[model samples]
Target: MLERRGVMVSGAAAVCFYEVCPTVDQYCQLRLIAGLSEKAKEAAEMALPKTVFAVSGYHCCDLVAMGRIVGDGACHLQLCDIAVHPRLQRQGLGREVVLRLTAWLDKNLPPSAEVSLIAKGASNLLYAQYGFVPTAPAAISMCRRC
Candidate 1:
C-alpha cells in the first residue's frame, strides 16, 4: 500500500502500470469515462495490435487508465488514446500512465525520434508538466475526415 495526498492506495485500488493494452471493452469503458468517442470493436481489434507500444493502469484488477504509442518507431511517434477513468481522476493515475510510457520511450526510442500528443484544452496543463509545449503557428495540428 502507498499513500498520496492523505489517501491510502492499495494493490487493489492504487495505480499499477502494465505494458499491455486494455481489452476492447475496457478501452470503450475508459474512453467513455474520459469523454472520448467510442470506437468500433472491429476497428479497435485491428488497431490495438498495431500499436507500437501501449500501457494500461489497473487498480485491484480494474483497468483504470490507458495510453498508446503509434507511428514509425525511429522518426515519428505520437501518444494517443490516453484516458483515465472518471472516478479515478485527480489521483495521479494519469500522470503515472504517461510517465511510464515516456520512460519507456526515453530508453527505447532512437535519438532522432519526434514525439507529440494532441491534448484536450483542459489536459494541456497536465501534459505541460511533463515537458510538452504548445507548437502554435510554427506547426498547427490539422486533421481531415476520410
Candidate 2:
C-alpha cells in the first residue's frame, strides 16, 4: 500500500503532496529537471517497480522531489535516485523525502542489513545528518557504467 501526506514547502507557499512512489513519466521528468542522470522510459519502468521504498513530492501534480531504496529486502539496501527540482532545492522537500525513506527503512530493515548510497557532490552533507558516514580509507565506493 502506498502512503500519502501533504506538506507546505517553505517559501513556495504551495502544498506538496508526497506519496510512496512516482509514476514512470514523473520519475523520468524529475530526474531530468533535477539535474540527475537521464533515464530512458523503459529503464525507469523497469526500475521504479523494484523500489524497496520510495517517496515522491508533487506540487499540483508535478513531481518536485523524490528518493528511493533498491536492493535485496534483507541483507543489503541502497538508497538511490534522490532528486529535487532546482526550484525546490533548499526548501526542505529533499530532506522530507529522505526522512520518509529512512523512517521506512528503520521500521523494515533487519538489524544486520546494510544501507548505502553513493552521495553526489554536497549531498553527502545532507545524508550525513541521517547517520550516514564517509567510508573512506577502509572502504571505497566504486561504480562503472554497464
Candidate 3:
C-alpha cells in the first residue's frame, strides 16, 4: 500500500487521504472511472515502476484522483494521467494532486529540466493556473495512437 502523505477535505466536506503513487490496479481503475484513455495492464506494470514522482488521492479506501511525472531524472519530464473522479470533480482534488506534483518537481528537478504535459480539451485551463502555456508558433503538440 502507498503511504499517506497528507489529508484533504473537499468543499463538500469529503475527507480524502493523499499518498505517493497508487497500486497498479488502483491506477487502472481510477483512469477508467475518471474518463482518461485506457492503458493496458502490461503497459501500466512497465510504466508505474518508472515514475519519477506520483500522487494519488483516496476518499476513504477508494481511489479518486491521481497524477504522475515520468522521464529521465535530469533532462525531460512530463506530467501524465492527471484525473479526478466525476463525483469529485470541481472539489480541487485534481488541483491538489497537481499542486503536490509540481511542488515535488520544484524541489527535485534540475535547473535545465524541461517539464511538459499534453492538455486535452479545456484541461489546459486548469493547467494554465500552474504556469503551463500554449507552445503555439514555436511548437505544437501532435500525437498518434500506438
Which stretches of model 2 miss by more than 4 angstroms?
Answer: 1-3
Using alpha carbons, what is the TM-score of model 1?
Answer: 0.87
Q: What is the C-alpha lDDT of each candidate?
A: 0.80, 0.84, 0.86
The window of 10 residues in a row where model 3 has the poorest summed lDDT is 11-20
Candidate 3 lDDT tens digits, 15-47:
455546788999999889989989899999999
Which residue pairs in candidate 1 have backbone atoms (N, alpha carbon, C) closer than 3 angstroms, thus clashing? 12-60
Candidate 2 lDDT over 53-142, as tens digits, reads: 888777777878889999998899999999988987898877888888888888988889999999999999999989899999899999
* lDDT (10s digit) by residue, model 1, range 1-146: 32222223533476667788888888878888889878888888898888988888777777888899998887999999999888878877778777778887899998789899898878988888777889897997887755
Q: lDDT score of model 2?
A: 0.84
The TM-score ranking, best first, is: 2, 3, 1
Is 1 or 2 the stronger prediction by TM-score?
2
Clashing pairs in 3: none
Off by over 4 Å in 3: 1-3, 12-19
Instruction: Show pairs that collide, candidate 2.
Output: none
Rank by lDDT, highest first.
Answer: 3, 2, 1
